[model samples]
Target: MPSFLQVAVLLAVVITAAKGAGALSKRLGQPAVFGELLAGILLGPTLLDVLHWPVFTDPPYLERLTRDLAELGVIFLMFLAGLETDLEEMRKVGAAAFFGAVGGVALPFLAGTALGLAFGFPLYESIFIGTILTATSVSITAQTLLELGRLRSREGTTILGSAVIDDVMGIVILSVVVALHQAGLAGAGDAAGGAAAVAAGSSGSTAAAQGADAGGAGALAVGLIVLRMVAFFAAAIAAGRWLLPPILRRAARWPGTEPQFAMALVAGLLLAVAAEELGGVAAITGSYMAGVMLTLVPDVKRAVEERLAVLAYGFFVPIFFVNIGLETDLLDAVAASGPAFLVLILLAAALGKIVGSGSGVRPFGFTWMEALRVGIGMVSRGEVALIVAGIGLQEGVISQAVFSVMVVMTLFTTLITPILLRWSFGRAPGSPSGAAAFSPAPGPRSGEAD
Candidate 1:
């Protein structure tokens, strides 16, 4: 464990670096998140290990603490995202968003699977790789659109709605894959046990019973995951419609904003925990739903958002972004996977989303150019990709080389999304010359519609 002094020093260094990098990135006309991510890479083993920093040389408990806090930051960030989503606007683009999300998910998944198989990976690993490609992290895209004053535009609304649906689909796919993998393992174990029993000349009943039990358990696990997901959303909607609003309204009337803010935070945290523990869904999803619930009371929604934004953006959110960078060792990853493989992986990640999601919105009457913008917007994979990759790594479903490639791909996509989004949106209809038309400005804060 790290001493108090070490922990304090780490926080100070991380915060300072994140803030300084963010400021520089903004000054350079890029998103602040880019700078924060880079700052982490510089301070982490990727660069700082060369200097033999104590923090890098001897792993400290502070690193774990920081990781946990960073997770909280993600939860808060997603909560804010949910709060900012305009339901009314989402309703307008519902059909387009649904189709876009489906197209986005299906195409990338198929491409990723085919690529992984072509690279000689096993069927399961290939499927997981494809699963990783299916997520769409739109925080970067949303920020870019907000900056361009297009977040409230038709395309923007569809992008945001589709991104949410994309996340849900990704989570479902992840659960299914994990459950199936577990079942496969159980079947293998049963086969091994049966072979041993036959060699020993023992009755096979015991092994058969064990196999039956294992099979049943695997099936039950999958069923529970699905049930929990349904229950969570159903409960969240019910609470939002009936229970939460009165409590929030009553809390809003209390002296000062503390009571209301405290209520919102507590509710969010509780829901997030429940989602993970009971619902088997990502905690960020729960927090997001909580934010959506809170939005039901419009009068206090802005107040809650304003106060929470300070806590989130001022500290936690930046740490989350930086922590993503710290987890990666890019040089080693490239060495292990080979440059050619890495390039292929990156291309698959980028092009899969573009083609999948872009094709999805075409039927919604989007111009080809507009569909392209939506596709590009969906290309940036952020925390969701990282979380899924981490799970795969922990479960030994993905190799270290694959994990590293995913981290690199996630960062690369995030960095280029804003530029691509800007370029795509800058091309106005009927403009003769395709010169850049949009001037980037600090738009509405992250998560808010323009």
Candidate 2:
């Protein structure tokens, strides 16, 4: 086992490096996350290999500790994501955001899966690749719009709303695909060597029997996956609605300062545990649900968010982003994938979101330019994609090299979005093609930036 001192020192190095890098990135007018990712690469095997210096006798134990911290970062990061979800804003954006998210999700998923198949990946792995491509992070776009004094514009609002819905959709799809992949694995195990069975089934009747058995197994797996997912969502949502409110309301009244914070954290942890053990979904999904539940309470939302941000960002979130780089060997990943897949994946990742999201908003009364703007706005992929990629790696759904390529792809999308979004909005508002108008849905908070 690695000594606690080694772990502490490693964390110190990581946190300092991440914070400094994040500050520099912010100075360059990019988000702090950009710097944090870059720092991870620099500190990882690609450069420093901080996790494997001569001082630490055992590396895996240290790795385990860091990974555990990183996992906490994911939970809090996702929980905050839930907190940011403005339901009222989504309601106002209505069909525009909904269609935008649907299109954003569908096209990317199809395109990514098709690309993976063309590249000779298995069906389940291909689906996982598609899932990786379906995430949208509008944080860069939102910040850009804020800088351009258009954060409250209809396109901006819709992009934010669509992003929120996009996250939820992405999570749901991830769960289903993961369950499907696991089910496939279980069926394969039960087969006890399919090739041997196939060779033995020489007669037509024997072969037919084998086929029927296989078909039956496949059908059962699908049915079970669907039922589990449905039950989880139903129970989780019901708990969020009925169970959470009463618990939180009581916590709000408990003795001691910010008792609700502890209670809320407990709730998130329990839900996260339940999500994996019972719901068969990621723990972060449950945390996210907990966050949404907290949002409903209204009374404790501020307290929880305020306290959580410090704990999350100051430590865990940075580690999570950095650990991504730490675990990735850029040169090996690139070599494994080759230049062609890298370039193609980048293309698929960007175009899938742009075309899918852009076209999705057009029929909903959005002008072509506005639709184009929305598409461009949704182009960035951030933590959501990274989290999914991490899970894919953990579940053995994707390779380390592919994971590294995806990390590179995500950073590329994030960096390029601000420039693209700014250029998209550069056209004069009075121009013929620039007829995008702020038609907020009927509400008191309409036209507000999410």
Candidate 3:
């Protein structure tokens, strides 16, 4: 591990770059996060390759620390977002958000799968591509909206709501594909060994038995994943509705520095851990839920809002954005894939969210431009796509080429969403319905789970 001295230097560099770049970006009329993210890319292999510097080289110790810290940033941002969310306002746009998310998820999945197959990839691989495309990391969007002071707008609420739904759908879809991939491997292995068993003359049933076992296992996994998802939602909502309020209410009376506020932060962290370890969902999901649940209590919301905003926006959240750029390698993969290939995959990933989500919300109360903004906001697949791509690579369900393309797509989408959102929201007309719901600048994807 790096010494504290070294760690301090690393932290200083990351924070300085993030804040400095953010300021520059704001001056350029873009979101500060855009600059923070761009700064990360500049610090990474795309330019300086900072991690390879002598200071950070201990078999990824600093690298891991950076990721963990970035992840914490993501959690903080999402938690604050939850605090700012107006439940009643979200409810007003619930159907539109739901339908929009459904469309956002469905169309990209189909398009990605078809594109994979068109290139002659295998069945499971094709499905995995579709699944990868289904992710909609809303972290960038949430931050951008916060920057623009639009977090309380109708479009903002709807986008936030749709992201939650989008993540659940994406996670569930990934689970199904993972099961199928595992089962396919199991069946293939069994079949390969079947001839040997047949030669032994005592095991005509070997292949059948193993196939049955594999099928059962696959189905069991998918079932458990779905069950866990359902259980998490139920428990989170129930506890938020009942359990948390009293605990927080009591905490509010304590002499500690914003005791109830501290408790709320703890609850968010605990739920974030649970979301990953038990709920079979992203950690951000839990944190965001914690924020949402805490919002029901006026005291906790007031306290947390006062305390968390500075910590999140001032420090951690910028790291979260910067770390995204730090982790990316935008050129190598794109250069290898050729222009036509890049354009095809990029278009498939981008349009899926834009066309699907946009149309989904348009049928409700949104204007065409507003719907377009919603679609643009959902385009960045963020960190979740990287997770899915990593899994596919580990399972041998996608080639390095495919994985690289995903990385490139993720980079493009992440870099573009903030800019697109600013453009789209800028053109959108202001109104009282959305304006009245405005709360403090809370920040989001179900994000870095984004």
Candidate 4:
């Protein structure tokens, strides 16, 4: 088959699988994202590969195409992620979210670093482990809340607010790590490679000669990255707020709003491209900021959201989730880390966010129980963790083994979140148990307005 035709056919199958699985998950009282993830695992090397699903057995370039489609999914997902955030509500929970983000990052890094020292894996791998733990998959968490009709509630708002902050902080950390990894500093490469560098840097003239260059390069790279990121964001936000509204206002008056779609399309694509070219920032991130800034114009915001939703959820989101499954290599993680380490990493991954983000709510006047609930609510790692893990694998910062553990971690946390939340709110006020009577009724998809 022609390449484009092959991709189209493969995506159709994957979406059918994801949608069926998603429906099944919702029927079972779980989030659709959970089903989508499960679909990935099943279609992956673990089981259904024997059935010869195209994505599982595709050639490299085809796989690359699938991944590119998936990247678009990520962008749309991030855009919706930006849309769902409420800055005003976040301000109320700001103190707690800030602390939570800090603690979430710190504890995982420290614990992972210490574990690496003890396990003999070297520092870089340890950092990767910690980085994996640092993410709070906002999509999964929001899905859970929306399912329970809690997305509009106090606790839901708090958790959502905290998650946005957590995500922003996570991206910043990723930027730094990616920059360091690229510059051949921060232990050079993976566990084996980094160990060699550490040894040479400690004892060899070669290491000494390269140290200054690595340090200088890393510094310059980080500086350029920060400046570019800031500039892109500043420009997008300012233009979005100051310039976009007037332009959109005029666009609305045009004879055909199909033109509005074109404008929106151009705006999203251009903003995304600009962000990448100018600052090396994820285009989705920049696009999301653009969305957020323009949210004040309700009519324009609603129109863009309506058009984007059909494109995003219908096509891109499913593509992204399915790609996650295809990329997962569960056996490798088990082989590398061994069972015991796997168990430890999973536990740390689950608890790290809970303790960090949960405890940080104390200064924000939330009850201990409320804080705990928020922490548990945020436990679902979902797609973003997998995205980071994929990046780590491609960069060779983590072996297939670590990536496998992350897949397991991501799936486990996502699967269990709804059950956990339901248990905690067992017949309590504002739980999904009370969902039927929720003021704004729950929608078919997560985070969609009634």
RMSD to the hidden true structure, all candidates: 4.2, 4.9, 4.7, 4.7
Q: Candidate 4, 186: how far from true, in Å?
A: 11
The local lDDT score (0 to 100) that residue 73 gets in candidate 1 is 85
The list of candidate 1 runs beyond 4 A from truth reads 50-52, 55-58, 120-125, 147-149, 175-201, 254-257, 394-399, 427-450
Model 1 worst lDDT window (10 residues)? 441-450
Candidate 3 local lDDT, 108-156, one digit each (tens) = 9999999878877888888999999998876678777776667767888
Cα error, residue 23 of model 2, in Å, equals 0.8
Q: Model 2 Cα displacement at 179 (Å)?
A: 0.4
Q: Once superposed on the true structure, which residue ranges of model 4 sit more than 4 Å away at CA? A: 1-4, 50-58, 116-118, 142-153, 185-218, 255-257, 429-450
Model 4 lDDT, residue 286, Cα: 65
Candidate 2: deviation at residue 357, Å? 0.8
- Stretches of candidate 2 exceeding 4 Å from the true structure: 193-214, 427-450
**In candidate 3, which residue ranges exceed 4 Å CA deviation?**
57-59, 120-132, 135-202, 365-450
Compared with the true structure, the alpha-carbon lDDT of candidate 3 equals: 0.76
Residues 1-450 of candidate 4: C-alpha lDDT, one tens digit per residue:
576776677777788888889888878877678788788777777666522554334467767787898877776666666655567767886677778667766776676666655777756777877887787766655665655666666667777777778777776676567655655544343334434786766556655556666656557766777787777777888888788788877877789647776676667767777876676665656666666765667787778777777888788888788777877667766877888888887788778777877787767787887777787877877776876777677678887777888888888888777777767655545445435645553222222211
Instruction: Extract clashing residue pairs from model 3.
Output: 447-450
**Candidate topping lDDT:** 2
Q: Compared with the true structure, what per-residue lDDT tens digits does model 1 show for residues 1-450? A: 346666666778888888888888778866676677788778767787422355443455556777888888878877886777667756778889988999889988888788888878888888988899898777778777766767767788789889878876887787667656765776677667767876888667876776677678767766777787788889988987798778877887899848988998988999889877777776776888888877777877887887888888887877776776677677888898789878887888888888888899998789999899888989988766876776677567888778778888877887788888989888445533311433433223442121
TM-score for predicted model 1 compared with the true structure: 0.86
